[model samples]
Target chain A: MIEAEGIVHRYPGFSLSVSRLAVEPGEVLAVVGPSGAGKSTLLRLLGGLEAPQRGRVHRRGPAVYLDQTPYLLERSVLENAAFGLRLKGWPAQEARRRALGWLERVGLSGFADRPARALSGGERVRLALARALAVEPAALLLDEPTANLDPANVARIEALIRAERAAGRAVVLVTHNLFQARRLADRAVFLLEGRVVEAGPAPGFFQRPADPRTRAFLSGEMVW
Target chain B: MNEVLEITLRSLAVSSAATLIAAVFGLPLGLWLGARGAGRLARSLLYAGMGLPPVVVGLFFYFLFSRNGPLGGLGLLYTLPAVAVAESVLAFPLIAGFTMAGAASRAEGVRRLVKSLGGTETQAFLTLLAESRRVVVAALAAGFGAVISEVGAVTIVGGDIRHATRVLTTAVVLETRKGELERAAVLGLLLLGVTLVVSGLLVVFGEREAA
Candidate 1:
């Protein structure tokens, strides 16, 4: 389980305020909003990449945060995937073996020896996913996982997240695409101007958003 | 011819020795300066080192290591070791300064991301060094080149003692003055060939990596 309460982080002319949020094991929670709505910032707070000014996040299992910009290390693809595991004190041989397995899961097994910087954008996104999932974290947090990827890559990433959920891992995803929310989100949080204006089942919220702001967001009338 | 070959080998040894020592001292300094932006003092020092005249460095070492100087009691003056010492100091700034610039130009975000992944501090630093591998190579090459081509410092501190401190660069100058033009030409050609081969290899390595 991942729990965030009373989270408030200040930024220039903007703020991220999540009064209460939780993700149970095996459930997927997607935060959807327009650009600059602090969707990515919310995920960053949960993943421990950015600290909240006045709240605490309690994560039940190991947490790996993939930032909006993928930071692939300047190492072999395999080494890059195995990095976090090694940091967690796993032996090099075991970490690398598991990383290789995850690479295969992401359809990048054949290119394990390639330098990571040589990978294309889609390949990089997949590789990032493999690295994140290799740790077997109880929850997964993704920031704009498919934003820069093409349709094919987008489909593959969505499939990966779905698989992780199916395997009984919790997922917290941040995205602007309503189609993604409708397709994969078990529950959705509709954020408007740094506040969670609506939170409920994805079907009900997408079908009937509680807030006028959320309705405007869904209609493209409230694009930031 | 045999004598000249012997001197050339001796000189190459001097230059290589100088370069190796400089790398030992300079690589770490370069990595630090690169990882952290230089402060006012460090920035000035780096710029000065980049343009440091070999003669000045050589002259400074000579005075310090010579008789009546601070290190005079050690009697290292006029020895090959002292020449190597002077040359190493001459190259230290170049190797370290260029390396720092290389390390700093990349994103600080890489550093932040590495830390967030829970990597050890050592792993983080090694990661940064790996990213700047090419820049570090260039710094090392620059250091080696400067020491090999130098004349005044080695000539003054080394005292041009025949067959003892006669490295290639100083030897060429000495031989030319004594009307041994053929010997000097051969030595100069050899030095030119070495620099060309080294620089050519670096350029090729850089180009291939870039592509």
Candidate 2:
């Protein structure tokens, strides 16, 4: 379980101020907004990428954070996947053993020994997913995970996210693609600038966004 | 010429010695400054150090170890240790500056992700270095080039003592002063060739990184 209590993060010309936010253990929350809408900022704050100036981000059990930019190591795919687990004091052999399972889970079984630098864009995303999942995080936080991916990879990533939720982990994903969010999100949060103006079940929010910003967002109108 | 060859070989050993010392003390310092996000201040100090006249740097250390000075009793002046001191000074800034830029640019997002994963401070920094190994390797090349090309500091501090401090660059100068420009040119061109060789190696690494 993850709960964000009055989170506030300040950046030049913008800020993210969420009063209260929480996700059920097995829920999937989609954070949707246009560019500069603080979607990534909120994800970073929650993911411990950036510390919030006020309030707190509390998480139970282990968590993994994946950013839009895949920070792949200059090593083989197997090594990249095993980094976090190894840090947690898993022996090299055991870490590699677990990494193989996650890589296979993300459909990258054949790429275990491949250098991470050589992976394609979609393959890189898949590898990033594999790396994050290798820790078996109790919760997963991803920022624009599928933004640069093509349609085929997007479907695969969506499936991967859905599968994680089905396996009973909290998943928080940030995206600008309304269609993608509509497909994968169980609940939706509409962010305008840095504030969440609408939050509800995905279907209801897609059909009837309460705030003007949310409605404008759903209809492809520029609200920021 | 044979005597010069002996000096050359002798100097290569000394320079390698200096480079090893530099690798030990300076590499980790570079990694430290890089991981912590020291901005223009650190850069200015490094660039200023890089641009330091080798003779001036030698003079500074020379004064420190001279007979009446603080470390005079240690008798490190006019020795290979003196040369290594100056060489490391010259190499330190190069090692740190280039390494910092190289590592940070390559691992910008890794720090954030690693911190989020509950990694310790040391683990976060180490993760950046490991993630950007090619960049760190390039930094090592840059450091090597700076230390090896330098003639002024090592020559001055090491006193150009025959069989002790008469390195490639200093010997090249000695040969030139004696009107052996041909030999000087040979050494000069060899120095240039070494630079190119180092550059070629870096380019190979860069290409591999690009891949």
Candidate 3:
């Protein structure tokens, strides 16, 4: 489980505040907001990637945060996927075997020897996912994993997130896509102007939001 | 032809020695400075060092090794070691600065990724070096080129001693001074050939890494 209380993160031109947030094992929580609404910042805070100025975040263990853009080490795909395990002092043979299995799961078994940077956009995203999931972290923080990906790739990644949830990992996802929230999230937090305006089950939040701002955002009437 | 071979071998030995020493001293410093995050002033100082005139560096070493200079007791002046010391001094900054820039360019992203993957600081640093090996190799190539083709410092400190300290560049200068134009041209060709071979190998290695 991961929990953030009174979290406030400040940047040069933007500040994001989350009064409270929590994700339990085997549950998926989606943070939905417009651009500049601080969805990513909130995820970063919960993931322990950044410290909050005015609050605390509690996590059972390290959270693996995946950014929108994939960051692959300049190594072969197999090595890149196995990097997390290697960092934790896992044996090279075991790490490679598990990494290769993950690669196969991600449908890149044939390209395990290829340089990671040479991967296409969708393949890179899958590689990033494989790399993250291979670590079996306590929590997973994803920021727009489907952004810019084709429909098929988007569906594929969504299925992987579901798999992660089924594996009893807490998943905190930030996305602009409402349909994805309906599909993957057990609960949703609606944020506007860096503040949470609504929080409830996915069906209730999307179908019957309490805040007018949430309604405006859900209706696509909010200009930004 | 045998004399030419001897000179060529000596030149190769001196320059390669300089390059190896500089890399040993420079790569870690560069990686540390890059990983710790250098400020603008530090960066400017490194860049200045990179651009420092080689002749000036050579002259400084010359005085340092001269009989009356502080380090003169070793009697290393006008020797091959003297040339190597001067050349290494000239190459150090280029290697260090390029490595620093390369590491800094991707430090933020790579470090974050490594940290997310549960890598320790040391692991992250080693991974950063591995990722930036191409840039580091380019730095080495630049350093080697600067030293192997240089004449001023090596000539000033090595004294261009025949059959002892006469590297290709200094030999070319001596042959030119003696109006041995053909000999000078041949030495110049040998210098260019060495540079080409070294650079070609680095390029091929870099391509292999990329592939």
Candidate 4:
């Protein structure tokens, strides 16, 4: 479980203020917004990557945040995948075993010994996802996990996320792809200028957005 | 010929020891300052230290280790250890400052990534250091290069005692003063050759690891 209330983060000329947000286990909440809409900031705050100036983030257990451009260690693919496990104090052999399992799950088994920097874009994302999943966090906050990928990789990643939700982990996905949000989100929130514009059950949010701005955004007319 | 060889060997040993000592303390200090963004004042001081005059460093150490000065009881003055200590002092800022610059540029992303993985503060720092190993190596090279070619600090502290404290740089100075210009030039070339070989080896090693 993850929750934030009265959150406010500020930079030089912009501020993000979200009154309240929560995600329950076994649920996926998709945050949809235009560029500069603070979706990534919201994920960072939820994941404990950044502290909000005026709000508290409460997590029931560990949370992992995957950045839009994931930062992979300069190590072998297996080492990268096993990093979080090693941090959690797992024995090296056990961590490697578990990481290997994740690698196979993500279809990266053949590339385990390869240096992480040698991987392609899609492979890098898969490796990152595998690394995050290997840690088995209670909450996964993902920022644009599939910004640029082929349909097959997207399907694979979406399936992995669905599996996490099925296993009773809370997921907060930030995406610009409305179709992806509609497909995967149990509930959805529309944000604009760092404010929640509309939020509802995913089906209703897509079919009958209550706010005109949400409607404009859904129709691709809101460009910013 | 044997005397010249001994002097060259002593020079290498003193400078290598100095570089090692400087790196031992300097790398950690640089990593910390880089990871946690030093203040402007601290950064300014570090930059100034990097360019400190070797003669001034020599004078400072000479005073500290001289009779009636603080730490004089150790009897380190006019010894090889005294020369090594002086060189270490001269080299510390070069190692630390360059390492700081390198780490500062790359630490933030590594820190955030490590934190998101539920790693502790120490883990984050270690990971940052590992990721910036090349930077650390370059800093070590800079430190070694600075100390190996230095004559002022070693001369002041060691007194360049023949067959005892004389090193390549001081030997060159002594020979030149005695009008043995050919011998001085040979010693100078030997110093340059050592510097180039060590630097080249470090670069090659770094590249091999990268590959």
Best by TM-score: 3
- The number of clashing residue pairs in each candidate reads 0, 0, 0, 0
Q: Write the per-residue lDDT of candidate 1 for residues A15-61, one digit (tens) a residue.
A: 88889999988888989887788887888788777679999999887
**Top lDDT prediction, candidate number:** 4
- In candidate 3, which residue ranges exceed 4 Å CA deviation? B203-211
Q: Compare the candidates by DockQ and give the number of the best one.
A: 3
**Compared with the true structure, what per-residue lDDT tens digits does model 3 show for residues B1-211?**
5998999889889999999899998899888788889889888988999888888988899899999999999999999988898899888999999999899887877877887776777888888888888998899899999999999899899989998898999999999999999999999999999998988887788657652
**Alpha-carbon deviation at B72 in model 2, angstroms:** 2.1
Inter-residue clash pairs, candidate 4: none
Provide the lDDT at A90 for model 3.
94
RMSD of each: 3.5, 2.9, 1.9, 2.6
Q: Where does model 1 sit among the CAPRI classes?
A: acceptable
Q: Score the docking of each candidate (DockQ).
A: 0.34, 0.46, 0.58, 0.55
Q: Candidate 3 chain B, which ten residues in sequence have the lowest lDDT sum?
A: B202-211
- For candidate 4, lDDT tens digit of each residue in B101-155? 9999878878888999999889999988888788888998899999989988888
Q: TM-score (0 to 1) of chain B, per candidate?
A: 0.88, 0.84, 0.94, 0.94
Q: In model 4 chain A, where is the ten-residue run with the lowest total lDDT?
A: A67-76
Which ten contiguous residues of candidate 4 chain B have the minimum total lDDT? Answer: B202-211
Interface C-alpha RMSD, model 4: 2.3
Q: How much is the lDDT of residue A149 in candidate 1? A: 80
Model 4: which docking level applies?
medium
**Model 2 alpha-carbon miss at residue B62, Å:** 2.3
Score each candidate by Cα lDDT. 0.84, 0.80, 0.88, 0.91
Ranking by lDDT: 4, 3, 1, 2
